[model samples]
Target: MRDEYYGRLLVQRYQLLEIAGKGSMGQVYQAKDTLLGGVIVAVNFLSRSKMNQRVRDRFMREATISALLGEKSIHIVKVRDYGVDEEEMPFYVMEYLKGDSLKEAMQNQPMPLPKFFSFMRQICLGLQCAHDGIEIDGNVTQVVHRDIKPSNIIIIKDATLGELVKVLDFGIALLKSDESPTGFMGTPAYCSPEQMDGKALDNRADIYSLGIMMFQMLTAELPLKPKTSSFDGWFQSHHYQKPKLFSEVRAKLDLPQALMDIVNRCMAKTAEQRPNSVTEVLKVLEQIEQNSAPLTTQSQSYTANTPPTVEAICLQSIWPKDKPRAEIVFPQLIQYRETEIATMWIMLSRSDIEKYRNNKPHSQFLFVGSPHPMLLWLTTLYQDEQQHRMLPCYLDLKKPIGEKILQILNQTGSYRLILFALEGDERCVCTIEGKVPTRKMQLLKEWLLESQNTGANHGQIKESKRSLKEELDTLKPKLVASLQRQISKKH
Candidate 1:
C-alpha cells in the first residue's frame, strides 16, 4: 500500500512526492496539488482497511476539526482539501509548512524572552478561536485541542509576522458534544490534573498545558518532577503534589513577576483556579506585553557609565561585619549582550529597598524594572490593591558610594551587577535577581544590629544605614524620568 501511493497519483490529482512523516494513526506525504496550481501540500492518509472503526473515526474527526478550526485562526495549520481515494482510504491536504516543530527548537536551547512571548501570544489566540466555538448547521460547537504541547506547535517563518506559530495535531481534540469513548490521551508531562484524572475537560486543560510549556521555555525544565514514566506517576504528581515555584527552581533567572504569576495560575490544580478561558489568558498576556514595552526598550539600550569590567561584582566586604550569620546572595547572569557600556543595570524603588530592610519572606520581585510612565500606566490599569505590587524596579546607572551597597546586595541576593550611570534626564528601571530580597536583607540587618548591641560599636552600624539611605534618597527623584535616552558620548 505504501509503495502504491508513493509512486502513483491519488485520484489522478495529487502527485505524491515522498513520505513526510508517519504516525500511529496515518502517514503524511509531501504532495504536489496539480489541481491547485501545483502548490506543495501535505497529504495525510488513513488506510481504512488497516484500521479499526475507532481509529478511522478519530482520523476523520481530526480532518474535520482541522478544517473547521483552521478557518477560525491563522495560527492553526490550514486544511485545504479532504476526500476519500478510490481504494476507500481517507486523505486530507493541508498547507505545507517549511519549518521545524517547537520540540526540535527547544533541543538547542530555550527561546529568548521576546520570541517566547510573541509565539505564546499567537498560540493563545489560536486556541481562543477554537474555544470560542465554530459555526456548523446554524449552531456553534466549541472545540478543545486536547493535545497541546511543544511537538504539536510548529514554528513557521511568515513574510509579515516573522516567526509564525502554527498549532497542529487536533487528532485528540474534543468537541462540545463529542461522546467518544476514548480513554486518557496527551503527553503526561504536559497534561493538566483534570486531564490526568480522566475528568471532563475544557479550555482550562489546554491552559494548564500552556503553562507547562511556558515553564519549559523559560527554564528548560518541567515544574513537576515525575517519579516514574508510567501514567499513574505523572497523574500523582500533577494531582497530589505542588509543582516547584518557577522562582524557586530558576532562582537566578530574571523573569517578570506578573508573567510568572500568570503561568502559575494557568497550571493551577483545579480548573476553577485556572484562567476561565483562553480569552482571559490572552488578556493577561497582552497587558503584560503592553506594560513591559518601555522597560524592554530600556534593557535593550542599557549601558553602564564606567569602564566595562570582566570582574564579577565583588561581594566580599559588602555586608556589615557584625552580621556574621547573615549570608550574601549574588545575582546570577541570565543573558549578557556586550556593548561599549553595559546595557543593563538593576534598579530598586524606595519602597522596594524598605521591603528588603523589613525582610518579608515569600515576597517575589520582578528582575525588570518599570519606567515611571509605565508604573503610572499600570496603576491605572489594575485595581488599587494591585497597583503597588505591579510596579517593577528599574536600573539606576548612578555610581555607588563604595562597596557597602554591593555587599548588602550580595548578602540579600537582591540585585544584578550591571554598572549604570545617568548621563542626563534619562530614567531607567531594570530587573534584579533574587527570590526573597526583603527577607535576606532583613536578616543581614538584624545580624548587624545584634553585633552592635553586644560588643561591636553602634556608631558604625547607624552610620552605614544612614549613608546608604542618603545615597538612595538622592538618586530617587533623578530616576523618575519618563524618557530614557542613550548618552551621545561614551563615559
Candidate 2:
C-alpha cells in the first residue's frame, strides 16, 4: 500500500501531494484541499491491508479526539475533515504545520530558557483545555491525553507568538466515561508511575509526561535512566525511582529555584503530590515569567576621580565601612553560561536597600569573578522575592582592581554582605567591610586561573557521571511500598 495513492484524488476534494510521514499506525500525506481553495493539509490514511477492526477503531478514535480538542484549543492541531475513500479505508485531514517537531528541535541541544518557557506555557494551555472536559450530548467528559511526548509536540512559527506549540496525536487519549481496555499505553520514558502500572488515570498522568518533557528540554536528557533495556525495568524505574534533581543535573545552567520547584512537583511520584490541575501549573509559570528579569549586556569604562555612578551607589549599600571592602576584577570577560544568572543579577539590582549616610544606593555593579560552580549554585538559589531587598553587584575576579575601585569600596559603611571568594583549595563565603589586601587579590587570581584550566576539561564529565546502581538501590524501598499499597487495594 506504499505510495499507492500518490497523485490520486480522495473523494474528489483532497489531492494527495506527497508522503509527509510514516508511523507504525499509518502513513500521512501532504495534500491540497481542492474544495477549500487548495489549502495545504495533512491526510492520514490507514493501510487497507493492515486495517483490522481494532486498527480502524483506534484510527477513528484518534480523529474524534483530535476534532473535539481542536475545536476547543488553538494549541491543538485542527482537524478539518474525516471520511473514507473509495476503497473504504478511513482517513482524516488536519491543518498542515510548517515546523519541526519538539523532538527534532531538541535532538542537537536544549532550547534557550525564554523559548522553552514559551513552548511549555502553550502546551499547558492546550492540556488544560482538554482536561476541562469536552461536551457531548449535554454531558461533560474528561479527556486524558495518555501520550504526550516531544515527538507529538509540534513547534510552528506564528505571527504573534513567534514559536507556537501544537500538540499532536491523540490516538490513545481516554475519555473518563469510556470503558476502554486498561492497558499500559505511552512512551516508557515519559510515562507516569500510575500509567506504567496500568491503573486508572486522569489528566495528572499527562502532567507527569509534560514534566519529563520539561526536564529534557532543559538538560537535553531524561530524568530517569533505566539500567536495562527491558520494558519491565523501565516501568519499575518510573514507578519506584526518584528523579534526579534539576539543580544537580544542570547546576551551571542557573535555572530559577521557583521554576525547578514547579517541575519537581509536576513529576511527583504520586499523582496527588503533583499539581491538582494543569491550570495551576500555568499559574505558577505565569508568576515565574512575571518576576523574571530580562538578560542584557552592557560595556562600561571607569577611570580615577570619576563621580560615583549607580554601580558605586549600590556598592556603598552592600559594603560597610567597618568591614573590609573588596572588589575582584577579572581581566577577561567571564562568560556566564546560564542566562538565569544574568536575569537574577538584574532582579537583585532592582531590589531596595537601606541608604548609607544619606547616600543613594546603586542598582548595578560590574561582576568580576572566576567561574566557580559553587558561585553559580549560590546564585541559582536566590529567589525572585529576595531581589527586592538586596543590592547585588557583578565583578570580574580575574583582573586587578585599580585604586579608584578601592576608594569606592572603602567609602561604603560596615554591612553584612555576601562575597563569593575562593581560598586555596576551598570556596569561602565571607562578609567584609574594609578594603581587600593586594596580596589576597593576587592569590585569588592564581586560584581562578588554575580552577579554569582544570574545570574546562573535567567539569561536565564529573557532573554527568552517576552511580546507576546506587540510584536503583535507593528506589527499592519505594517500590516495595507501592506494591504493598496495590496489594492492599485488591484485598
Candidate 3:
C-alpha cells in the first residue's frame, strides 16, 4: 500500500517528498519549500491519532524551544516555521541537514582525540545555551533535555569550523518551571540516578547522562550494564551499581588522566557530585586539549605526541593594590604566528575563583539599554593571551545569583580595568589605572536597572558586542591621555 501523505503539500508551502523518519510523537518528512524556490527542509507533524491536549502541548513547546534556542546558538537545530495543516495537525519545518548521527558514527569506531574534543565542546555549548534559560512569561527558565544520547546529536562536515554538531529532539525536554511528569522518560543506559527514580532534576542530571555517553564513545561499551533491559533493571543499576573504570573497560586504551577524571565526575551517581554547569566542563576540556597528547593504543604508542601548553601571561606585579579582592580585566597583546593581536584577559579573586572549582561559575550577561544595545558577560578563568572561550548566559537581574555578583562588586568597592593597543610596538604601550569610587555605587545601581530593562534581542547579541567595541574604541584615547598626565607628574 502507498503512503497517504507522501505526495501531499503542507500549508500549501511544503511539498512532502518522502518519509525521513518517525518517532513516538510524530513523523518527519523530507519536504521542499515551494515558496522558497524548492529549497529542501524537514517537516515534522504531530500524529493526528494521538492529538490530545498533553501531546499537543509537548509538540508545540518543542518547536518553540527549538526556535528560541537555535537563534541563540548554532549548535542547536534551527526551526524555520511552525503551524497547523488543513487537518488541524500541528507541524514545524527545520533546516534540512546532511550529516550522520553520532550513534551511526560511533558504530564505525571511537573518534580521534582532536575530533572528540571539537565534537564534545560543540555539544556542551548547545547544552549550556539551553541551561542558560530562555525568557517565557516574563521569567528566564532553564531547559533540561530529558533525553540526551548519541542518536540525537548530528555531526556535519563544515568547511570553516570543521565538524559542526546540532543537538535535536526537544520533545521530552523539561523546562525548569514545568511541573514534574510521572514515570521514567529517557534511554535507560544514559539516564541519571535521579532520572531513573523519576525525581526532581537539574542540569547535573544531564551531566550524568553525558558522562555515560562519553564513556561509550571511547570504550564502545557502557560503564554499567543491567541484567535486564527493563525499567527496574536500569533503576537498580543506576542507583546501586558503580560505573566501571576506563581501564576496566579497555586495559590497553592509553588516555589522559584528566579526560578520565572528567568522565568519572560527570557520571557521578548523585547530581551534586557532578559538574554544576557545561561551561565548567568546557573550561576543563579547553585545558585538556591544549595540554594533553592524543590517545593511542599500545601498538601505536611510538607515534604519540604531546601538544605544547599555552604560556600563562602573569600580571601579579601590576595588579591594583586597593582592589586586592576584586577581578581585573585587561586587553593583552599576543604574538600569533606573524602578527600581534589583542585578546581579553581576566585575573580572578579567591571568591570569584571558587565558582569554577566544581564547574559552577557566576558567569552571566549584563545588557545595556537603548541609545545603544550592549551586554557584558564576565569570563572567570582566562587561559591565554589569545583565543577566548565565550560562554554566554542571560541571568535574571532580580535573582539571587545576579544580586550576589553585584553585591560582591560593590563590597570590593573597585576593580582594575586595563587598556592596550594591539597594533603598537610595545605590549603595554600605556597602563591606565582607575577605580569605581564608593560615591559612584549609586551610578552602578542605575546601570544594573538599565541592563535589566534592556530588551534581550537574542539575534542581535553579536551586533551588541560590536556596539560595545565601538564604545571601548571611544574610551581608549581618554585613558591613554590620563596615563600621559600621570607620567608627567612622576617626571
Candidate 4:
C-alpha cells in the first residue's frame, strides 16, 4: 500500500513523498508541489478502484466547498488545487497542516477552562461560517458538516493566537439545498438523535455533535454511553438515554454551571430545544466571559457612582496611536493593561467626549461584502447609567479601511465583532449597532446574489441599492428596538 504511491507524481505537479493518512474519501499523501518551489502540501486522491460518479461527485464537492469556505474563514482547512490523474482518479492538493488532532490532545483528560473557551469558540466560528451557507448557482445553501468530532479538529501553534484551531475534513458535509440523497453519515459516538434516524439534517444536527464534543472536552468522557460500540448500541444511547450530568461524572469537577447548561442544551433530544443558531450560543459565551472577568486593580478603584474617565475608558495610555484613527481593525483586548477586558478605543477631542457622555447615543453595524467588500462597524458604549457614547468606522476591503480587519483577526484568533467610531461632529448625533439575533450578513449576501443575477443590462446596480434601501427600512425599527432594550436592560 505504501509503495503504490511512494514516488508518484500527481497531475504532473505534486510529487508524493509519503502516505500521510487514509479515510473513506481517499488517501492523503504528504507531497511537494513542483510548481511552487517544491513546497510541502497534502494531496488527497479518490479511491482508485471505485471511480463511480457518486463518489467522484461527493469528492469534487468536498474540494470545492472546502476551498470556498477556506477563502472566507481561516478555521477551515484550505484546498489549493484539484485535478484528475491519468487513470481518471480525482485528487486535490491542500495546505499541509502539522498539528495534533483534538482527540489526541484530549487524552482522556478535561481541557482547561480557558483553553476550552478559546478552542470551542474557534470551532463554533468555523461551524457558524459553514451554516451561514455559501452561494451555489443562484442559491445560498447551508453546509452541514455531518461529521463533527474531536478528531476532525486540528490545533497548531501560532505566534499571535497561540493555539490556532482549524476544522478539517469536509468530505461528508451536506448542502441543505442539495436534493441528492445522502445516507446516514456521522460518527455514531457523536451523532445527533436526528442523524441516527436517517432524517433530513440541519445546523442543529451539527450543534448536537458539537455538544458531545463539548462534553468530552470538559469531562474527557462521553455524555451518553452506548452499551456496545456497534451502530445499534449508539443509536439506542443517543435516542433514548439522557446525557449524564457534570456532577454524575465527577463529584468535584470545577466547571461553570452556565457552561454545563450550554452543553446540555446542545445535546437535547429534540433540535427545537437547542439554541437556534451559533450566534445565540455566542451571546451566552460572551456572558460567560464577562462574568468570569476577575476584578483588576483598576476595577477595584472605580465605583458605580464615579465612572472611569474618557481617557481611561478609551485606553489612551496604550492605544495604537501609529495606526490611523478612522481605520477599522480587529478588536484587541487590553491584555498588557491592568484591566483585561474587551473594550473599544477611540480618540476624540475633550469637548466632544464630554458632549458624547452627556447624551445617550445610538449605534449600527452594516456589512455588504459580496458585490463589494465593505463593513460599516459602529458602536455605542454606555458612558453611565443615564447616557451613551457613540463610536463608528467604515471599512472597505478595496481600501485601507479593511486592511487589518481580517488579517489581524486571523493572526489573533476567532470571530469577534470589532466596534469602531468616528470623531464627533455636528452630524455625528446618531449611530447604531446590531442587537437582533437575525443574520444580517446572510441577507446581504443573498441580495447581492440576486442583484448580480439581474445582469448589468437590467440596471443591476441600481436595483440592488433600491432593494437594500427597502431592507434597511424594514430592519431599522428592529435594530432601534434592540438598542432601546439594551438601554432599558442597563437601567
Output the worst ten-in-a-row residue range by lDDT, candidate 1: 372-381
Give the per-residue lDDT digits (tens) of candidate 1, residues 414-444.
4333222222122322223323346655644
**Local accuracy of candidate 4 as per-residue lDDT tens digits, 120-139:** 77788788889999888888
Kindly provide the TM-score of model 1 when superposed on the true structure, using C-alpha atoms: 0.59
Question: Given candidate 2, what's the lDDT at residue 424?
Answer: 16
List model 2 lDDT by residue over 1-491, tens digit each: 34677889999999998888854368889998777557788998887777899889978888887888886666888887899998898999988888999999887566788678778877887898799988878899999998899899999875323466888888778888877547888888899989988888999999999899888998888889888857888887888888888767777888888888988899999999999998888877755754563311221223333332333222222222222223331111111111000111111111121212122222211212222211110111111222212232232221111221222233331122323322211112222222233554454444444533432212222232233224434654554454345545756
What would the per-residue lDDT of candidate 3 be over residues 213-329, giving only the tens digit for each residue?
888888888899889988889889999999998888788888889899999999988888899998888777766765664322211222114322112211212322222233344
lDDT of every model, 2 decimals: 0.60, 0.61, 0.66, 0.68
Question: For candidate 2, what is the lDDT?
Answer: 0.61
Model 3 CA deviation exceeding 4 Å by range? 293-491
Which candidate tops TM-score?
4
Candidate number achieving the greatest lDDT relative to the actual structure = 4
TM-score, each model? 0.59, 0.59, 0.62, 0.65
In candidate 1 the C-alpha lDDT for residue 74 amounts to 67
Better of 2 and 3 by TM-score: 3
Question: How accurate locally is residue 69 in candidate 4, as Cα lDDT from 0 to 100?
Answer: 89
Worst 10 residues of 4 by lDDT: 425-434
Residue runs of model 2 more than 4 Å from their true location after superposition: 295-491
Per-residue lDDT value at 41 in model 2: 88
Give the per-residue Cα lDDT of candidate 2 at 153.
92
